[model samples]
Target: MKQLLILCCLCFLSAATLAQATWIWYPGDYEIWLSNRMQNRRTDRGTFFPVFWKMDSHYPLMDFHKDVTLSEPEQVRIYAEGTYNVKLDGQPFEGTPTVITIPAGKHRINVKVFSQATVPAIYIQGNKIISDSSWLVTYEDKEWIDETGKTSDITATKWLHAGSWNFNDPAILPSAFTLPVKPMAAVKTENGLIDFGKETFGYVKLNGIKGKGKITLYYGESKEEAMSDKGAVNVDWLTFDKAVSQDSTLPASKAFRYVRMVTAGDIHIDNVSMLYEYADVNEPGSFRCSDDELNQIYDVAKYTFHLNTREFFIDGIKRDRWVWSGDAYQSYLMNYYLFFDKGTVLRTIYALRGKDPVTSHINTIMDYTFYWFLGVYDYYMYTGDRTFIKEIYPRMQPLMDYCLGRRDKDGLMEGQVGDWIFIDWADGLSKKGPLSFEQLLFCRSLETMSLCADIAGNQPDAEKYRLLAADLKAKLFRIYWNDQKQALVHSTVNDDVTRYANMFAIFFDYFNAQQKEAVKHTVLLNDSIQHITTPYMRFYELEALCAMHEQSYVLKEIKNYWGGMLRLGATTFWEEYDPHESGPAHYAMYGREFGKSLCHAWGASPIYLLGKYYLGVKPTAPGYATYVVEPALGGLQWMEGTVPTPAGNISLHVSTKEMKITTAGGNGILRFGSSTRPTCTTGTIQQTKDNWYELSLSPGSTYVINYQSVK
Candidate 1:
């Protein structure tokens, strides 16, 4: 009898421990609020430049509640942002009570808050009753009261699990969130102008400034841009009447490697420095090889990607610091191979897929909307977190419905008036009719919807989406596939064929082997076909090549293209790189001086290419429960790197003669080809095909394979 009592006490203690909580908000409300704050910070030539499309806001009023059945009475401390009212078990707490005592029983705690400028959020703490994502939150609780003081039914009101991150401490509010920063001194000062030696982002601080005067600071991503006061994208004008020397920090963060400070009326400054603001993510993935140029390209690509991975995965640091869906889609892929920061990926996905009124497409682009769906699909595939899918699936349904409603007479996606048909930033790219590329992406998105619906436990919707995807896939081939050309035509308009659809088809596995090989030669290698210019399309273009086992050829192309940027003194990759463009002409884009961003997120494709294709570590099943590791030398004498998975890291070292692999988690199949039979002492090797061998690998095991180099 005493032992039974002790077991009951232990179980009670465990239950209390499991109730530890963190900050909570209406799911995705904080993301929308924060994105608005971040995107509105853009300044062009000292003028406020905001998005051309309609901006969204969080619900001004929100109600959060949690039902608890406690073993004993508990005192709970409450903290909230915005004007709020507290209620205990459907009864009002006279005022906004910071501390409330509740009797032990089945009870519901509610906090309703209103804020026009910020998101409504709350943090609650107690021994057994605490606040976290487990709490239910609703923007419209709909508990209307009548004249008799009787509340109406709220059965129609929808409640979702509250959204949260690592904001566990009640002392720190979510509204006060900011990226961490560090001081960086200028590399050199040239007559009133200071250069930070490389393109950077963050607020600039002026140290030891004295006297009364007007100071104008021009910010630039390039040396020429800084000197061009009128052309600089960001500028700061400050009027100082200080009697004593005071340090001043800029009001907003700007992207610039150089700053030109022009002072008038006896204003003087001592030194210049900056607070380099960045996301706190560790570099778990690394790549090194015999080729120095490739290594340099990889390092610069990593830096470029990291710089753009801030509050959300933005497009670039210099201009339009917005969470673009298509750009973020690539960033997600690159992130999977690099930081594998699930928080950032989830944050970005939520921000891009803002609240579900399903107005215009994401970023007002058709292809981008499709990319958003694909991003969600890839997120589930890589992380294997079904909870996110369950939470996000509702949003996905409406988005797919929006696309379905917009289909043309033939049921293909075509650009409407407000929709931006941004396939790529190519010259004279036809977007007139229902482009095959859009249909291809739309088909894939439907497939994603089907997969997510299954995970979200909506079997009817899953079947609906599956049928839609199947029908669309059939149409994709029937309508777009051209036999004589042996490739998917660019558009149904004039039967023009481009690399976009064909390349995407290759990696998406939309094409069979015969069609894939045919398109690989006819479209990919066909220079007569309009060459893809942006690194964005190049990502898929190269992925298609690597998929076709053209890694050796891709190695040369990476060196020529990415390496060309390095030869041109690129501290980070460019928004677009054209080798033919010479001198300052390289800096000019959008018909403006220094308009091109030097650190674009989409340019960091090598992170994905090397990790997935070279290291060959990809999840066969979700969450790395089952995976495949097939390393490719890609013309390198030796290469080594780590690919991050939800389970852990898969490390690999490969040379021409032998290969070594170690994984921290997951069951992996190590497959490779050799001129002779490969020998593995730690595991049994089987001949999968002629000159190919496969070994089964378990978690935390290292395997060394001795083989004669096939190449």
Candidate 2:
């Protein structure tokens, strides 16, 4: 009777543990597998179009194990994909038993699975042990025996914490994972053309359709492209011999604002709608200002971000839905100020840095490789996930070593035969010689590695990378910084003073105060310098401007550029925007009729700019343990925003007459400039200069101060 009671208690405990059980696989295995599936889903002109780079798959066979201690015997239920075997204390279980009994005391459980079609994964639930990230997983293929016919020490075998993406349900296999979708009707349909009223991504839903012969739907980001055959970037075709009289949705999701439906023979169409598929990410960060135009820009930017944010942070919804490292880097920064979706950020990072033999740069772009490293740096700074840093460090070292080995005689990174020096999509852009931009990003990446190494407890490599970064930073200045030009020249061979390197240097803090001012005058604000037409590079250009306290000027530029797109009836932001171009010409890029992605992820820069620069809330310490909030009105009458942090949300409202702030949970220092002395009863105030004042704050404090804004 006592044993029965104990078993009942153990059963209850095991049920509780089962709630936490989730399917687990080797880290980065499922990510690479899912990314390959997503990247290859792209199609152009009714034909499949995939990424040029090599796609990696998950390991077919995997071994997962865990050692546990229990005060009493407990029952464990096991579930897994693929054929598998179980072992307890070196004794193999007969066949594959789903239910097993473990005796009291210490025991090690092991599950081996083989799945060629998808990632081999497992789930186990017991009183104290469950399949989760705590379990170690490996794909070690080698084994050796001693002279005594006993297995040798397996210490050399590589094992890592199993990866789990919150798949708590045992029935919902990771291989069958798909995003949620909902029905969406078109806003208008005129003359067989359907418009969703804004840029959207989903499968086209045919309602009440009885079709025969061929049916074609051309998708486009603009109205003109949907109506023209050669202009539309995506198309779907279907054929029916007899009227089926049923609702049918397209197989793949596509990006489109307008769709031109063409039918042949007995095909009949009642209405046009869609099943909109979207990522479910939270929007904890928000912004509202007196300027209506800027508010619209923020809303549209948010929508753009939502479209690009899927299982991974992709570049865009339309063309090239592939995860580009450079694009994902910008998305990560914007995410810090918006969704704060650390999981999505981590997934994108892992997918980009796949299982590495260190063959080539990420996305085959030199700058993109560095961007991936920088993404890791920012991820730690924002989320304070030290475990991820340590987990990814082994791969980081090899990737960085691959980069270090690719240097020229002077320890500079020059474009190699296979490397694509894709700084931006600009015409007449030179891609020869050792580019200053690559070196600048490379130096930043090295510094990131040093910081990550410290977090990962690699002291020797940390110092080595630190010194290497320092030497490279010094070399970059010596080789590229032309004192007369007051800007980092574009490349060693061309020596053109472009905005890419110079603007990046300012915000990177690689340049001094005098150098920042000089670059601002010569490159950033210089009219003679070739202008940056793409939103990709413009993100950095604007960030550099904002970093220099040029918020007022940057605000005007934002209005002139992003607001300019809004003025032209843009439902969502574009990959590239030029005031000089108009109508259908604005939609053209890469020598194609409609190659530009209208709703690009990088187009959502206002979210980052307004949150960090204008509202002026940023972390002084990692994970917002300490942060600084320096609100800049930037010619606005009023502005209020909430910046998401790992702890909580930091809310702020600013006007010429008053300022209000409520910290989420951090040591905050609020800095502002006043025309006159400001008075506050909420906190202690210190005057740093003639106009600037600083106020100290603690966690969860709501402070209201009466102040006059300084011009």
Candidate 3:
């Protein structure tokens, strides 16, 4: 009995230690430093390529502190990066102490550190005292000392909750983090040509390489591009002077499935392999349906999204791995449905909004700036992390202030010098004046600011922004709404009717029922309007239809558009897919032979659409505290899937004859339409609409219903 008691106490102590000890740094500093290392890694044909926009660095100095009340005296082990000092209850130690003893009762511990090349971070652990996010951190300067030299003058400074991630082991530093990689071999090998059989991103490995010679590998998403020296967009040129045979691997990672190898002199490689590098994230949500082709599209889209999800959600793995707000906005929605990885979403938001004096719009694009705000709005609704909203509110105000400062006399946003008003990548799209689309986004951002301001406890600013948003929304309709076109015009300067603003207004809830019906016929379904070719915009276009209860029509668009790319042998979705182009012409864009990215993040919107619309699981309240599930078969024989929330997963299985659902948490309503009266296993069913019925759901109960399909 004595031995068992001792073992139990030891296990409890170990668990407590594990729970409390974690490395931490200034909030968002490690994310910025990590992204700096990841973004500068892009290489174009062996020439160094970096982002054109300004990049920010981590704070060189950081102060971390923790105040605790202890019942017994204890000692803590200290670990940190760079030169540091320790303080105990406002008293300085002789030097930085690896182990320090604390007295019983209340006391405070402070660690100050500085490092120019990396973020200053620390880890502390003990039997009872441990470093964790409960600690506070700041980067303010407090060097002004009193005449005594021991006492110091303090200035007003703000401290935030320290930031940390999965770096729990002290042996592994945060700055040394890297994605794990695994070895893979070619599926097919020919004379100087190799194919991995599908699209992949990794470093090339040459096995049994020897002698001194020149070797070059041309990478391609398609077979033809790899064989053409002039057309290949990515290449590896290596010079060797080795006397013995040994395996060699390239330094930089590239995206490719096929590689055409060329060598000069006596270079010889017996075999070829690759090291596939990928982000580690959990896929908590899933989807399946009766249609095999739609299932395949969802699978490929998930792959495409995972490829672009790296240190930050990037545009593509092949080129410009830098985070773009517009691309990441779509990725965040897709991630909520698939991975539900909160770390990636937060990291991408931090990396894009860097530490700002409000320099330029995120990615230097006007529309991208608004998308960042929109992403924040969605992040809160899905996760309901009020702490994150409070932390980011400071950055939000300044960015909004910058936007407000740029407005013209009309209180409207217009393209200014050095501002790129990028709405889409179409050929004839105009950016010449105060765009209706920009105004729409700006108004939405203001509304987001108002919501966040209320959450952050800034009631004055919240009311101010609410009124600002209301005024801009009214101006938007007056300036851009055209009765004849039944759509919002493209711009005030041209007064041209376009689909951009009208389609956005539908899902944004800016249009009335009568206006939405009119615009759907005259602008969305109208053939004369310039057709959308890029999957980026197609994401929203299809979403507009889905929001209007046109999931059946949107399903066909998904088949013809995303399915069209799959029919073209796309292992991963493309940056843009236009069914008009054929052969090598499908790969050409921006005047370069292979400038277009074959695997892009925004191309993966089916994950969001199917999970949210077809499955019809959405949060009517923050964090799924209250949610509604209204499944749409959309002509499918059967469909089933799960949608993730902070609470847990909401799973649903639906078919023509029956419907079933199980929720992890939240008060939910299972809604459906049955031409014949529906019967449920449990719960009271009430007819909510002419053909629709609603069933209240509790968290742990599994509700099954038998119903006949309507429509």
lDDT of 2 by residue, 1-711 (tens): 999999999988756655478999999888988999999998889788989876777899998989999899988898998999999998999988999999999999999999999999998887567898999888974554332334577655566889989898888899999999999999999988999999999989987788577888999899988998877989887886645677878888999999999988887877989999999889999999999989999999999999999999999898899999999999999999999999899889889998768798899989999999999998888888899988898789889999999999999999898999999988788988999999999999999999988887778879999999999999999999998888899899977888898888898899998999988898888899999988898899999999999988998999999999989889899999989987889988888988888999999999999999988998888888888998988999999989999888988889889999999887989999998889899888899988999999899889998999987
TM-score for candidate 3: 0.96
Candidate 3 lDDT score at position 617: 92
Q: TM-score rank, highest first?
A: 3, 2, 1
Q: Candidate 3 — number of clashing residue pairs? A: 0
Query: lDDT score of model 3?
Result: 0.90
Clashing pairs in 2: none
**Per-residue lDDT for 1-711 in model 1, tens only?**
999999999999865685567888987888888888899988887788898766777888989999989888998889988899999888999978999998999999999999887788988988778898889888885654333324467555677889998888888899999999999999999898899988889989999989999999998787888899678888888899989999998879988888998999987788999999999998898888899999999999998999999989999998889889999999999999999999989888888888758899999999999999999999999999999998898788788889999999888899998999998999988989999999999999999998998997778888998998899899999998999999999888889988899999999999999999999899999899998778999999999999998999999999999999889888889899999999889888899888898889999999999999988889999899899998888779999999998777889989998889988778989888899888889999999889988999999999899987677
Writing each residue's lDDT as its tens digit, candidate 3 over 394-490 gives: 8898999989999999999998887988888898898888999999999999999999999988888899999999999999999999887778999
TM-score for each candidate, following the candidate numbering: 0.95, 0.96, 0.96
Write out the backbone clash pairs for model 3: none
All models, RMSD in angstroms: 5.1, 3.8, 3.7
Which residue pairs of candidate 1 clash? none
Clashes of each: 0, 0, 0
Report residue 82 deviation for candidate 3 (angstroms). 1.6
